[model samples]
Target: MQKHTISAIICLAGALVAAAIAGASFLAMRKPDLIVRGPGVTDVKMLSDWFPGLKGTPGDTEVYILKGADDGASMLVLGGTHPNEPAGHIAAIMLIENAQPKSGTLYVIPRANASGFTANDPQEGAPQSFTIQTPNGPRVFRYGSRATNPIHQWPDPNVYIHASSGQTLSGSETRNLNRGYPGRPDGTLTERVCYGIVQLIKKENVTITVDLHEASPEYPVINAIVAHPKAMQLASDMVLGLEMQDIKISLEPSPVNLRGLTHRELGDFTDTLPVLMETANASQGRLRGRTDEALVLTGKDKWYVRAEKLGRLYVPYDEKGHPLEERVGRHVTAISELMNSWNLEHPEKPLEFEGLPGYEDFLTKGIGVFLLPLPAKN
Candidate 1:
């Protein structure tokens, strides 16, 4: 064979191999993570059951219900609103696999934006997934993007406008589930998902709604709870309760001007009191050195430590950075305290549950210790 012909063949072969590897990765991302139902899960339903518009769509997600034996006020817990924030989703997963309601129902949507879980953000250098070592073995969970997968909802406009509030944001935020609140049934895929959630709240008469989240360590809102006006009193009491446990969380009132956020829209549209909690996550921070599974799990970033020393961070940081256990612990502890405060204030409408690990327990035992074992195959 001629020299040039030989070189061309080798180049083509390498390109084909690279394409094959890329295809396999794309396929793997499409596979959903396995989430086992724990003892507390009384029933499992689809979000479409409330709003049929999402039926058979990529936007549909699972809703795990743990109903108490006695009648009382109910609460809805949303995790994975932004899938990149692992603590929120992990906390919701832990609750699904552990909490057993005693007085009122608890509805948990661990993957609030199902479409977002199927892909990673471009150029983010993020891990596709992470694993937790459980007693039975290892359980893998997806580390996904912050917005709806472009594959599902594509081509952003120059500006995105809120359906109800007429507020505008950058086009990229149109796919953000957080900014699609009080959504429209006849809107975009993200908007439809948000509409389904709003429908669920109104239909179920949820007394309270808690949206879990994480923020970059440098973000001022880190380690804080943002509550709607109607929920301010409840959040204040919960903050005090958490402080008593030495958890050290701050309280912020949801900005009325923030049009599409859950704490604002949910409270404005429905009778449900809305609150959102945030934790420090170094893996998602701009100062993070290398984004990988370890960064997501351990959160020990030297860059973040340096940033902290420079007084550029909102949360305290040291060599023992904010580990996944600590972040998840903060979220779980806040939810537990919120429930306690709610019950204390509204004894007749108590929201009670059991089996959730405390903050100290998460720190000592690690997150894997609380994860329930997978069921046996038939």
Candidate 2:
């Protein structure tokens, strides 16, 4: 056989192998991650249950409901609004699997944008999934895209205009779930998801709505709580409570100009007090050195460390970098504090919950230990 012929055959074989590997990875990511029901979970509902327009679409997601012993005020917690932010997603999962309400209903959406988890962002080098070892065995979760998959919501326009306020933003944000709040029923898939969430809040009469998020270390909002004007007092008191516990979270009022965001639109359109919390994530920062699962979990990047030394980051960074557990700890603890503030302000319609471990629990026992085993199929 000719040498060129042999080279062509070898190249073809390599191409076929690469395609096979890629296909396998795509399938694995598409398979949904499992979340076992804990003592707190009373029932599970779907986003489509509230807004049927999202039915049979990727925008549909699970809603875990935990009703308290006594009928009282309600609260909604959104996690995985941005799938690239693993800490928020993990914290939401932890809440669903651990928290038990004592006085009111606790609603949690672990993957607010379910479509995002089916694909990873291009050129980011993020892992398809990461594993946490529990007592039973190992559990894995997806590390997904920041926006809805283009497969579900395609072809971005040159610019994104908020429907309610006519505010303009980069076209890519059209797929961002965070920017599609109080969404119109006839809008895009992301808007439909937003609509469903709004319906859930309205129908359930949720008193407090917390949108959990994670920002790059360099972003100005790291380690902060952003609240709408109506929710500012609750957030302020929560920040003080967090500070007393040495969590030290800053409070920022939601900007009126940011029309599409939850803090702005949700508060304007609904009675629910809207707030967003952000934790510093080194892996998502532009100054990060390597992009790998280790960076996602450990959050220790030499470049971010050096950037801190140069006074370039918003949050403090050091040799003891922000691990996944620490980031989740901050979110969980802050959430608990927020509930404390709400209960204090609304004594007649109190919101109280227990079984949520705080910062110290995460420090002592790793995140994996808190995760329950997946149920075996019959």
Candidate 3:
């Protein structure tokens, strides 16, 4: 063969190899898993139902609505705002798949940012999915990214100025769903998702909005409730109630200067009271030794334990670690307590639900037991 012919053949082979790798990567990110709804989910709709502009976009996500026969107040729970935090998302899923409202309405969005779940933070070395064994079988859930996938909305500015409060953060934060509250209809994809959520709260006349999240064990905000000023009283009561049950949770006032967070912006922009809860997860922490499925589920990290020993960690960490079940349990129990506290304050508009496992139950039984089985193939 001619020298030029040989060179062209080699180049063609290299291009084919590159294309194959790219195709595989795309499939890994785009594959969707089945999440069977529980008895409580009476109706399911997309976030686009509230904001038509989001229809057909990756920003659109599912909203599971559970309504009771009696007239009462309504609440909205958002999980998976930051995809790396599995506990928050799983806890919300637990509610969606198990809890049944008897006196009011419950709106649970387990994957509030569906697009985020389609990808993982590139440098994190995190697992693509984690499994929980149910009685029926093992169910796998995605371990996603901390922000909206940039592929959906790119060209972030050098600095991101929040639309409502003009608070500036790093450029990448523009894609953070929590920071895009009271979102603008014409804003970026992240802002649009936030806008859709705000629209839902307003249109439904939601009384309370709770956003579930997890922070690194080294982060000071872990194992605490950050409530907007309007929600402080209710949150305080709930914290006290949790204390009675031996669940230690701290209460932090949403900072006025921190303008774009859910606790801050959602409370400031809407009539509905807003609160956010955080649990500690070593997998997402800088002090974590290795990032993988075991770290995601077991939460045990030698580095975290050493940090705890040095008193450098915010929450207590040991060899046993702060397993996923414990983190998820804290979230589920706190949410129930918040509802109970809300009921005590507003008897006429009480929100009641059943079939949800509390902290002790989760600690004793584990999270996999409550997860529903995946649907059988045709």
The per-model lDDT (C-alpha) reads 0.94, 0.91, 0.90
Q: List ranges where model 2 is wrong by over 4 Å.
A: 1-17
TM-score of each model, paired residue for residue: 0.97, 0.96, 0.96
Off by over 4 Å in 3: 1-15
lDDT of 3 by residue, 1-378 (tens): 999999999999999999999778766876655677999889999999999989999989999999988889999999999988998899889999899989899999888888898888878889888988777888988998899888888988999998877889999999898888888999999999999999999999999999999999889898999999899999999999999999889999998888778898878778889999999988888878889899999998899889998999888889999999999999999999999999999998889999999899999999988988777789
Q: In angstroms, how far off is 202's CA in candidate 2?
A: 0.9
**Per-residue lDDT over 1-378 for candidate 2, one digit per residue giving the tens place of the 0 to 100 score:** 999999999999999999999989887887888998889999999999999999999999999999998988898999999999999999999999999888999999999999999999999888888888889898999999999999899999999998888989999899999998889899999999999999999999989998989999999998999999999999999999988988878889898888888898889999999999999888778888878888889888889889999999999999888999999999999889988998888888888889999899998898998998889879
Q: Tell me how many clashing residue pairs each candidate has.
A: 0, 0, 0
Candidate 1, residues 1-378, lDDT tens digits: the string is 999999999999999999999989976987887888988899999999999999999999999999999999899999999999999999999999999989899999999999899999998899999999988889899999999999899898789999888899999999999999999999999999999999999999999999999999989998999999999999999999999998898999999888899999999999999999999998889889999999999999999999999999999999998899999999999999999999999999899999999999999999998898887779
- Number of the top-ranking candidate, with lDDT as the measure: 1
* 2 against 3, candidate with superior lDDT: 2
